[model samples]
Target: MPADQELDQELDQELDQELDQELDQELDQDPTGGYRPLVVVLLSPLAFALVFASWTIFAVLGVELKALLGFGEAHFAVLLAMPMAIGGLAALPMAALAQRIGGRRVMIACLLLICPFLWGLSHASDYHHLLLAGAGLGLGAGSLAAGLVYVSGLCPRRHAGLALGLYGAGMVGAGLSYLLLPLISQAYGWRTAPLLYLLPVLLVAALLWLFAEDREAEPDVPDPLQESPPRSPPAALLRRLACWRLWRLALVYSFFYGTFVALALWLPAYLSAQYRLPLREAALAALPFTLAVGVGQVVGGALADARDFRALRWWVSAFVLVCLFLLSYPPFVMQVQGVHGVIALHYDAPLWGFLLLLSLMGAAMGVGKGSLMRLIHRDHRDEMALVGGLALTLGGLFAALLPLVFAVGNEWVGIRTAGFMFLYASLIACMLVMVWDHASDRGARA
Candidate 1:
């Protein structure tokens, strides 16, 4: 291994070069506009981040609730998943409404919508009460689409990927639960922990109302004569929904984003169980993966903006495959006959190495999230609200379902690393689809 001085020198040189390049570039500007686009991208994401925090709060809160209420594992898992499930259900309706009323209005309403749920959560005395609060809180998931439409609307078409990435980075706010929940739950009480969210939610709603610009609610109405008059409204919608390519893109997004969220809730417990780390320590340990994902979104989006991303997708997926292959190995002792004697072998990932691999996997997924979103917008800018809504909906449902899958894998497979193996297999299936898609494209070209 290199000495400390050599590593430090190399790190310092890299940092200096990055800083120098940033300095040489002029001040940051919004796409095709002045500071307004920047304000939209930044402020809306800030609002989204606050709302996003609630989506994962139940995971933190459910541990205590499950015991207090004396529930089984399945019920507890359902409680943890309620927000995402309901939110996914709500996204399409909310997106349709946003397309009518404007994303700014929908965003403000979604932010305000979380306030009452926080109050209810603080007051919840029964499992049903908590479930109701959680379901209501799930409505805030619709804000992902609102934030997407809001941020991308202000920027020019070319910059849509970076804007979406910035908005998606708001997911980092889900980490807030890991930071503040345990402390507040300890200092006050679990009941009072939800109260801490009330003030900020209200404040963000008001700020969005006063400051954010409103895009025209909908695209210009098409002349009736331009369409086939015999087609019914439902038929028109069915045709729109029949796009297989759109479905594929949405499914791809669902896996990346869904996996990010699933791991966010799962890793804390996984780390605690596998390595026998303390619960709080495991939560803290997970911060690197979340942080890398947040930062990587921007880096990936910017790269997509600058060049072709078709090949990048393959390379990144391959990298994740390698990481997951390493992660999927369960701790075991193996024996084999050697030339001289029987040999014994033991294998288990050290905590640091596992965390390092998680960070790498998270980064690659974030890049994929960014670049693929850019591709979606590049092709479907006119229908962004609808397409983005479909993506968010699928992602939320995917996140909601994965915990059960993980639990099933653990129980039936009788392996601690079963979750990773499941992810590895699922990702391989997704990659195979990508390969098929690429081959088809090449054949079509020929």
Candidate 2:
């Protein structure tokens, strides 16, 4: 061969190797993809659990922190909601960050940085120190956005719903940590809980960095612009946010996720105040609620996989409406002490009935959480980043308010009806969104 031809052949070989590597990445993305390493997927959640568990530590320790910091209920609510608020607000930026630095790198960075800050949270002498510490923790935990984006890229389209549900199970770690950390705090004081929490993050971060590989780019995906397409500058990102599906999904997540987040933060306080339950007892009672959420995610994923989009969407929406109705109304069964033994009789109360309904709202959220993203991804392939980021932000923002709203309500409405009103409104809004979505789909078909 001539010298020029030889050089051209050499360059072609290098390009071939690059293409092979890229293909390997796409393969790894599928659940059964060769790159879909079982060990990493199983263990990544352990790291995620640590990050998430730390996110809600304040909620479980709110009373203790309130007394120690000499803060009021409103302040305590603000403190508990701060991490979520920051996490919500920062999700989009973090998603972009993941693309820039790679997901593993960002996650590891946050994991390490947050540990010392968590230690700071344990020993803060004043509000400024606490606020700074909360910011660090929130930024660190917000890495969940990056991880979800990373995982979504890796999982096969067929199994993405299931994988997402399993990944979401990481939230259960928050509940477990809440149950355990307070007990540890009771013995050692609230100051030590955040410090001890650092160990899990450090270990998980190390395992992730060692095991997780960089996700490959999808070069073969059909380009929107056929020829030379100008990359949209970051400044135009807000314009791309015009995808209506993003708002629809965000609305769905806002209600379901809002309920989950709010209930998780407020339930411990509610049980403690309303039932005079001990701290440990209140935490234990809240476990049932969290368990329901975890279960709902799995069930929702399965239902989505099995059903058609029309059926899946309506069923999920209707379930949410029913849950809201349950939240708005509850049938109470009473145990009357009689001559022989306590005989149980059922009575309906608009109050306790609503609380029970609030609990059922998880089932509806579970349906949406598990399945809705699949449909979104299917329809809005090009806008996944925008959709996911906004959906999470909406969810987080709505959730962030539950504790604050409850606190304000307790102060104003004589304690009994305050929280329920917000819960009622949130559920109603969620139900309305679902109903509107169903109606819209029907009209579009017509």
Candidate 3:
């Protein structure tokens, strides 16, 4: 009885020590009188929203710009797509730079870099000038990669998923373009649309510079006996990036985020062509898909913070698959013979039904993306910049490529629903890889 009491006393003491340590950390983290954490966390999403808006402005403006410039379909298509491709390609290099320097510095630079391009685009008169400006705006993708690292660095471990989800939710800025551009175009002109972004971009850039500081991590101590000179930045980045686990995360992210971007880009055109709807009406119909996905990120992030995200991801995938399977079918008609007459069956999804399915699929993708991202930080917080960059790189490249795939599906495969078919196929591949990865992991553990 005495021994048992002693053991219980010791356990109590240990618990008390842990609680004290947690209290100390909380006190230390908010040394600037508690407001700093609030400001930093809240401002991050708002600032990133501006960056996202700047990145996607061409989505709303491209139709008018094409008409104004008298550009061909080819030129118009390229203009709509150029920045995303450029951004995705640039994400890796920018992320490497962010690791060497800091994520905050990279974020500031990215926002500032787009300002000149936004201004140039505002004043651009010819196709070449607009193209040049659009290419420059691609730097905005780098900001997203860096922002992931930046928020991960600042967030407390207990709240990491929620913070990251909020940042991801800033993608609602895409919807902002949909809401604001038509009004701006009507009041001023399409030329004034790009200029509308200048102030918010500049203000966000300034605010980030002034208030958003990177939470510097402690430098690792050198190993005494096995020490050699540290690798150069490029060499170090390349070396760190040579992990199968990291590549797997990239592939998983590409499946969710890439397909999300592809649908966002392809939906307007598909809705218009398939349903014979006006472009504006089609764009409006597609708006809820983007919004649902953005909001789902926040919900997913919060849930993953406390739950098993691998399981969460599986559920998300299943839900999306069901939606995609239905979406992948083209409008079809069937004739059936009856005893006395012939009956015809039609399976063309109504516009509202199509929108509903697309929105649900988007929500699933958002949840998967959020949970996976938080899982990355939970396992590899120290290497967030590198892993985050590589993941964004793959996702961006896939986003850039999926549109072309959709185009090929439409033109060559002769399926108006080809894009959805491709998305469905790609998602299945990702799920298969995940299952294989899990099986291998269990084997290793066993």
Per lDDT, the best of the predicted structures is 1
Model 1 bad stretches (over 4 Å): 1-35, 218-227, 230-233, 339-341
Candidate no. 2 TM-score: 0.81
Q: Note the residue pairs that clash in candidate 1.
A: none
Question: lDDT score, residue 240, model 3?
Answer: 72
Tens digit of per-residue lDDT, candidate 3, span 262-334: 5666566667678987656766777899899898999888987775466777888889988989999898899
Model 3: colliding residue pairs: none
lDDT tens digits, residues 1-446, model 2? 34654575456446545654775676756554664445445655666677777876777887677777798877877877787788788877777777666767777887887888898888899877877777777776556777767666665545556766766666666687667887898898888888877777887887777767766554656668778665566646765776455687667766666677767777777777766777777777677667667777767765554443434655666666555444433235779899999999974544344445655766566666777766555444445556766777887787788777877876765553466566666666666776788679657756
Error of 3 at 64 (Å): 2.8
Q: Report, for every candidate in turn, its global Cα lDDT versus the true structure.
A: 0.77, 0.68, 0.76
Compose the digit string of candidate 1's lDDT tens values, residues 1-446: 23653565456446545643552342243232455566788787787778777766776655667768887556666776788788888887687677778888898888888888899888888889988998998899777678787776666545666888888888788688778887788788888888878888888778777766675454667687876555775686578889777776777777888888878877776786788876567777888898889888888888877655757777878888998899999899999999999999999889999999999999999998888888677656677777888898988898788777777766667786877887788889988888888678667756
lDDT at position 309, candidate 2 = 44
CA deviation > 4 Å runs, candidate 3: 1-30, 70-75, 227-229, 337-341
Least well predicted 10-residue stretch by lDDT in candidate 3: 1-10
